[model samples]
Target chain A: MDLLTNILGAIATIILAFVVGMSYGGIVRKITARVHNRLGPPWYQNFIDAYKLFGKTTAIHHGWMQIMGPAFLMVSSVVTLMFVPVLNNGGWFTNLNFKGDLIFLLYLMVFGPLGMALGAGQTGNPNSAIGVTRGLSQMVGFEIPWVMALVALMIQFNTTTITGLMDVQQMSGTWLMFSSPFAFIAAVLAMLGMFRYSPFDIVGAPTELASGPVSENGGKFLFTMMSSGSIFSFVKLTLYVDLFMGGADNLIILLIKTFSIYMIPVLYGIVSPRYRTEQAIRFFWGWPLFFGILAILYAAIF
Target chain B: MINDKNSQKIVDIIQNWARKHSIWVLAYGTGCGAIEIPPTMTSRYDAERLGVRGAATPRQADVLLVTGYLTTKTLKRVIRVYEQMQDPKFVIGFGSCTINGGMYYDSYNTIKLLDKYLPVDVYINGCMPRPEAVLAGFGKLQEIIAEGRANGAQKYKDNLEWYKANQKKIIPSLLTTDYNW
Candidate 1:
């Protein structure tokens, strides 16, 4: 029974990952279109693309580098999956909950982009080189505020396991969104920056950089990236939802909270112009990061 | 022996031929021309009724719509993307850029004619073409697909170097001091 349960869970996880990714992608596309006052592609548009890419031929830059790209993508998303809890209980991998700490899960988040950069760097393509450089730039810009926000949250909750944070809301009947609003807002902004949606899309701007690091990856590798990116986004969003709006016995409220948060950035993405790397750096380093750190100190005192 | 096998093959062919009309488009919204492609595709103009919807990747898209001017830099990447798509693909040359360079006619970076570099079916003309014109082009391409002459993917594979030479007419480097992707 345990073995059968594991098989079913793994299969279910993969399917959810696929749908979650497509849903995340759909929302991004639809919201950007709405922001522009235009009708975007339908919600399942991302799923269609994934299906389409899988059917197409794969282009391996150096052939060998293909292994690293998908492996890292799969690994990083899998790590996120392990840390994330479902239904107020430890998710499928309870062992991860036992052995891994908050630091481990956070470290896993850093692995993905680095792996992508290394894989692209080996391709020796100039456009991809520029893309990897911008990804690094984006990482450098957002990391400070993201860290500050996490630090603040840690001080407020006084625990590291993501479950503890979620459980805090469940036990206290107050979501962090209302609890440490500043840290919550900062965390939201930092995550959006990490996603590099609009303006901050300096690294992979179609008009400027042209798909950036993923430019060279085609066929199976592109498929893997799409699937992993889609799934991981869902994982990330779920983590956010779990962090902010727990204890909703009614699923509608939870769905509404998740969808609304996703919509906020998506709407902004539509009407916005891609930011020059300099603008992004300024946005991250200036007031946002400063205020985020201030929130941590405030949380510590209170 | 030939009659029995041929008739069975013909039956299989008819079923497959009926499937191509629902051609998904992978619209590479490259430039200004992409403006018109989607409007022609949505409920207002209703491309779904015509069996064409914009797809995110080149793989699922049977029709690759090059909506506007292909910058020399973009064309190289375009070729790479085009090559990645599966067989039985159709390249819809939409707008003046894909047809004859549109507003970028003299721009050193733009490809004056996409056909010189890539095989194009159904040239739909307009500097910034209307949604109706895009649908008309889609209709024309679908007709070609139905007739089985629109599959350009196989031609590309058969003579890769011959086609790469077709793009040699483009001196993309002349447009920039140092060519950058």
Candidate 2:
């Protein structure tokens, strides 16, 4: 009975993530349009785009790996969501959080991109290959700071579990952003690359690489990629909230925190010019890496 | 079963509605009329307000906008792009040039009639249609999609032989490989 209930809860959480993430995406588009002094599509534009992609009647796939690309991404997003605690007070929202899942969560996050890379490799397009290489390189650059921040928190609190970290935050009455300021800064900086915005969006340079890794994907394949992206964005935001914002006690608060965290990248993307691939790698390794090392040192000393 | 069918119909209606609004156009510019597209997409007209955005590749694009006259060389490439697009796709023949070759009617390289080679869902007839006319063309396409009248993909498939023959008449070298769509 408990297992059945957990499964149902997980499904519900995935659905909620999809809806909220897509809505956030639509809102981001609107905000971007306004920034450009233009009237954008409605806040529900992403939902419409996703639905339309699914509605496309014909699609061409290169092979079996092409079919698995979006599936792997979806699995990774859902699995990451399952491991993260959504609310400060655990219930249905904390569907599948388990002790020491933080390391597993980190690996799962990379798995989707690896899968996508393999699929893109099969497309026989030089652009896809170039995009995948840039994406993987950017991933390596960002993960260093991200992992260091997580490790700093883990060492400081003596807990490798996300819920355990959240619980500590709740008891202290101070969010990690205040307590471990260096780690928070490093994480937020790393997130700019994680969100794949300008300066770090060398992989999917739409005009240059023709939307990069998913260049060959269309119809249902593109739809799957789109939804997976939304869900993954939500999962990443939720992870950040759990780590820094003390996690939300309810859905409204959760949305507020997640949306605010999401804007760090969106707003940053708007103003900045895209960096070349090597320049992006160097950017991540520079200040963000410095901050990550400082965070670890701060945790160790204090 | 009846309930299932009704729900499926509802899904179809919703899907059609969404597809009608979000038209991702291929970023391929074929002729001089391509000059008008940039303004339509930018802040002045902002085609994105109507959910019309530029797509990077033919695979992801929903509409192929062939602007102005297609020279024999360009038509070969355009046809290949058209074939590469997924089902439920559209072709917009922009300007009087695409409609009837415009000033290039006497030119041996320019194709006089575009519909002879590809199924065009909409045509904006102007020497060079303004961005407003381009937006109106998109608006008309949305209406066609909503009414389930955008059957150019199917028409292309049904009349592939004729399209191929007309295409072969111009490009005797046959530069395109069989995409096998």
Candidate 3:
């Protein structure tokens, strides 16, 4: 009975994450359109797009790896979601959060892109290979500060679990965003690269690289990758909320918190031009890296 | 009774509705009509609100918009792109040139009729159709999709030999691989 209940809870959490993530994507599109002084498609446009892609008649694959690329992405996103604590108090919303899951998550978060790179390498498209290289390079660039910020937080709270961090925030009546301001700043800056919005979106550079790694993918393959992207974005936002803000107790609060966090990247993307690959790497390693070092010093001293 | 046929029909309707609302157009700018596309996509016209958006590549595209005249050289590339696209795809012939070669009617190399080489589902007519006409063409396409009448890809498949014969008459050295799908 317990096993069945746990399985059911995991399924429920996946569904919730998918729905929230997809809706947030649609809202971001609407906001982007509004910024451009144009009326956008309805907020449910992404649902239509995903469904249409799902319903497409033909899906072409270059090889076994091409087929597995999207599968790898789906696994990574869903697995990442499993480790994130969706609600503050333990309930059906919480999946597999455990001690030291933060460090595990740091590795798991990057596993998808690496797996995708291997798959894309098999496609034989020069653009795909180029995209994979840029993507992995940018990953190296962002991971440093992201890790440093997390390390600072872990040291300050003296716990390596997300749930423990949330507990500390609750007990002290202060969010980590206020307590470790430098770490929060560094993490938020790292997130801009993680989200791959404007100024950091050269990896996919649609106009230049033909949409980068997934240039050859279409139909069901594209559908799978698109949903995985949506779910992964939700996982990242929820993780930030859990770490920096107090974890939410219910669905509404969760939405409010996640949406607020999401607007940072979305609004920034709207007004900015894209950075080249090296420029993006340089941008992350500059001020964000400095903030990460400052965060570590602050945590150690205080 | 929700028998197999009825259930299949129900699924078809839902799928068609979803497909109608999301049109990813791959614009093949073969001639001067390509200039009009910018205004159509940007804030002035905003075709995105109508569910007509640009796709970066042929694989991800639902509709192939052939903007303006297609010379024999460009037609070869167009055929290759169209073939690269997945099934249930569409070809839209944009501008008067595509309808009957417009001013290129007297040109030796320009293909006079588009449907002879590839099945065209919709054609927006003008010297260069304005963005409003382009949106109207998309609206017409949406209607056709909703009615289950847009089957250009199927048509091309059924009469592949005839289309190939017409194509070979213009370009003797057509080098695309066989139609796998």
Candidate 4:
């Protein structure tokens, strides 16, 4: 019975986490549209996308490379999942709570998208190459802030376990999002951008470049990449919530806080148009960097 | 959960208006309908506020706007992209190229009716529909959405054969019941 509960918990948590990430994204997109004075999709829109992708026939370039594309994405996302303490919040398989673990894991998150981009580039198509390059450039732009924000958290908290950070928050009764308000603000903004939504989403903008690098990836590679992305996103979001909001035995609390952050990108997307590559990098380098550095200073002083 | 970023009164009003306004279009310009998209997006027919910019990629696009006639060569790419786009994604066949294959009616390359393959939401009429005709089609699309004409899964199940037929026509070698790749 205990084993069954554990297994069920893992499964439910994984499913719920993925759904929340997806649904959270959908909600955010909807809210952004509403913010822009337009009615957008219902909350379930993300799931509809997942289902639709499954329905479409998968394609492969070279049978070997195409097979590896989605495989790498899913594997990378799963690796991303391992580092995140989703249900229990302490740590689990491949948890990176050891010295430099948090930093190591954070860097690891970049691989999934990077691998997907490589897979797309190798398809030997110019259009896909353009898309991947754009994606890589966009990822490069946000990489700095993403690291700085975490460094700020690590500096203030003095520990790197995503779980340890959450433990501190629970014990101190103050979330890091609150610990360094500027860091929280900046990281929230950058992390909101981690998935690379609009203004930053220029990397994979389809109409502009035909789904970017991912345009070339198909068949199981596309499937695994997308499938893992969904679940991996859930784990990532759950980790964020657990770190910032504290974990719960019940799922409702999980829903509220995670959904709140998940909506950040969606809301930003609705009101603004996508930026040019130059503009996107400029915003990341200028505004986010200032805030990220300030966050570090604030962490030091406190 | 405890914090409310915007006041309730304002949020409600804005949310209401947003539901009726901005509509993002993917604008998959393959054949000729693609040609008309530029004029509509330019200053004269500016669709910026309505969120009608052409998304170059399928993932972030809200609607897939078929701009012209799809050839056997281009049709495969179109279908693949059409499938890639996220859900709540609408498909608009913007030219006679898509609606009935226009001048290429008897040509082997053209798919007689695009809807036979994908679930088309709005069908604009014209050998090559003008930008004006495109907008009119969009207005109708918004109306259909408002009236709840988008039935996702049902539309897919009903049009499975159509999509399959298209797959065979475009990527014949790839049109297998099982994808080994």
Candidate 5:
């Protein structure tokens, strides 16, 4: 009975995350349109788009791996969400949140892109190959500082579990953003690349590479990628909130915290021009890397 | 292969509704009328409000907007792009050029009739259709989609032989694959 209940709880959490993620994506579109001085589609436009994709009668596939790509991406996003505590306290929203799962979360996050890369490679499109290469290279560049920041936090709080870190913040009445400003700054900068917006969106340079890795993906395949992308965006924002902004105790607080973090990348994307792959690599390794080191040093000292 | 007519009709209604609301237009510009696209997409017209956003690749696109006249050379590429697009795709022939070759009517290189080469779901007849006319064409497309009258993809598939024969007359060295699938 307990096992069944737990499974149901997990499913509920996944559904909630998917719905909220897509909604946030829609809101972002509306916000972007307003910024451009144009009225956008309805906030539920993404829902209609996804539904239409599923309803599409015509679909083409390259191979088994191509089919597995979006599946892997969706799984990774949901799995990462599962490890993070939804509410600051505990309830139906409280995911598995097992001890030492931070490392697992990090690995699962990267697994999505690696799976996508394998799929993109088989498409026989030169654009897909180029996009995958840039994506993977950018991954390497950003992961260094991102991991460093995570490591610093883990060391400072003496906990590898996300819930443990949240507890430390709550008990001390100080968010990680305030306590470890260096790590916060490093992580935020790394997030610019992670979000894959402008400046670091070399992977999916639509103008240059025709939407990059998913160049050959269409209909249901593209739909799956889109949903997984939204879910992953939510997971990333939630993780940032839990680590830096202090985990929210309720739904409203969670939305407030996550949406603000979400804006950092979305707003930045509107104004900035894209960077080349090499330029992006150098950017991450420069100031962000320096900030990561400073964060580690600060953690070690105090 | 939905055996039940009523169930199939119901499915189509829902599909049509979703399809009409989310027409992802491929950003492939084949001619001079491409100049008007930027304004339509931007704040002045904002076609995105109607869910007619530009797609980067043929794979993900729902609507292929063939702007202005298609030379035989460009026609081959357009046909290839059309074939590459997934099912339930659409073609919108923009400007009088696509209908009757407009200013290029006397040109030896331009194809006189686009429908002979590929199935066109919508045709916006104008010298160079203004952005408003382009949007109106899209609105017509949405109506056709909602009424489930847009069967151009299926038409192309069913009449592939005739289409290919017509295509070969112009581009004798057809470089695209058979596209039988």
Candidate 6:
């Protein structure tokens, strides 16, 4: 009975994440269209697109690895979702918030991209190869400040698990956003790259790279990637909410918090232009790196 | 129930509905008519509102928008691109150039009839169709899709030899590697 309930809880969490994430993606598209002064598709457009792609008949693939690419991405996304806590103190929503889960999460997040890189390489498309390199290089660029920020939080709170950090925020009655402003700033800056919005979006560079890594993917392969992408985005946002904004107690607060957090990258991406790989690395290492160090200093001193 | 004709019809209806609402056009600008595409995609026109957006590659695209006059030289590449696209795909012959060849009707290199080489699902008739015309053409395609009438890909499959002969007449050195799939 316990095992069945756990399985059901996991399924519920996956469904919730997929729905919220897909809606957020649609909202971003609408927001982007509105910014450009055009009427956009309805907020459920992503769902329609995903369904269409799912129903599409895949005719060709380079090899087995090409077929496995989306599967790897889906695995990464679902696993990451399983690890994230959706709501604070909510039974069943906390799927696997074990000790030292944050460190495990940092590694798990990159696993999908690397697996995708291998699959893309098998397709033998030059653009996919270039995209994979740029993506990994950009990953290296951003992970530094992101790691520093997390380390600062860990040192200050003296806890390795997300739930422990949440407990600290709850007991203190103040979110970490206020208590550790520099870490938040550094992390948010790293997130701009993590989300791979404009400036940092050189990995895909759709106009130039033929959509980068997924250039050869279509039909069911594309559908899996698309849905996994939505789920992954939700996982990232919920992790942020848990880490910095104080995890929400209910679904409404969770939505509001995650949406507000999502707007940071989406709005920034709209106005900014693309950055070359080196320039993006430089940008992250510059101000965000300095802020990360300051966050460590603040944590150590106080 | 899964194998029943009625159930299959219901599935087709739902699939058509979803397909009609999401059309990813290939961003291959084959000719001068490409200029109008920017405005159509941008704020003033915004084809995205109707679920029409540019896809970056042949693999990802549903609709191949042949923008303008295709010389014998370019037709080879266009045929290759169209073939690379997956099943249930479409082709839109844009501008007067792709139809009767417009001013290029007398030109030795330009192919007059596009449907001779690939099945064109819709044609936007103009020297250069404005953004409004482009959107109208898309609406027509969407209507055809919703009605289960857009079967250009299937038509191409059924009459491959005829289309290949037409293509080979223009580009005698056309490679057959694209047809193997």
Best candidate according to DockQ: 6
- Per-residue lDDT of model 1, residues B1-181, tens digit only: 6479888677535533433445667787788887886578655676755546655455435678887888877887788667656555778888877877777778977778887677887799988778888878878876776566775766665665676666655643422212111
Give the clashing residue pairs of candidate 1, or none.
Answer: A21-A230, A52-B60, A58-A219, A199-A274, A199-A275
> Native contact fraction of candidate 1?
0.03
Q: Return the top candidate by lDDT.
A: 6
> Compared with the true structure, what per-residue lDDT tens digits does model 4 show for residues A162-249?
7778678778886667767777666666765576677677866755766666665542344456568677767767767776666654
Give the candidates in order of lDDT, highest first. 6, 3, 2, 5, 1, 4
On TM-score, the stronger of 2 and 4 is 2
Alpha-carbon local distance difference test for all models: 0.70, 0.90, 0.91, 0.67, 0.89, 0.92
* DockQ preference between candidates 3 and 4, better one: 3
DockQ of 1: 0.15
Q: What local lDDT does model 6 show for residue A238?
A: 93
lDDT of 4 at B103: 89
Higher-TM-score candidate of 3 and 5: 3
Residue-wise C-alpha lDDT for candidate 3, range B1-181, written one tens digit per residue = 6668989899989999998999999999879999999999989999989888888889899999999999999999999999889867988999998999899999998988899999999999999799999999999999999999999999998999999999999999996466566
Can you tell me which runs of candidate 4 are displaced by over 4 Å? Answer: A1-10, A32-39, A87-100, A218-221, A247-249, B1-181
Chain A superposition TM-score per model: 0.91, 0.98, 0.98, 0.85, 0.97, 0.98
lDDT of 4 by residue, B1-181 (tens): 3247557545434432332244556777677666777777765665543545555556545577877778777777877777665555578878787777788889987777888777888899897777778778877876766555654435865567666866786667754344222
lDDT of 5 at A214: 94
| Model 3 lDDT tens row, A1-302 | 88888799889988988888999999998999999999988999999999999888655768899888889999999999999998887844567978899999999999999888888888898999999999999999999999999999999989999999999998999999999999999999999999998988888888899998998898998999999999999999999999999888887898999999999998999999989898989998999999999999999999
After superposition, which runs of candidate 2 have C-alpha atoms over 4 Å from their true positions? B2-12, B175-181
Better by TM-score, candidate 3 or 1 = 3
Better of 1 and 2 by TM-score: 2
Residue-level lDDT tens digits of model 2 in B1-181: 6469888787767767998889999856878888999999989999999999999999999999998889988988898898889888999999999888899989988999899999999999998899999999999999988878889988988887788888888888876566565
Can you list the residue pairs that collide in candidate 3? none
As for candidate 4, its interface RMSD to one decimal place is 8.9
What is the docking quality class of candidate 2?
Answer: high
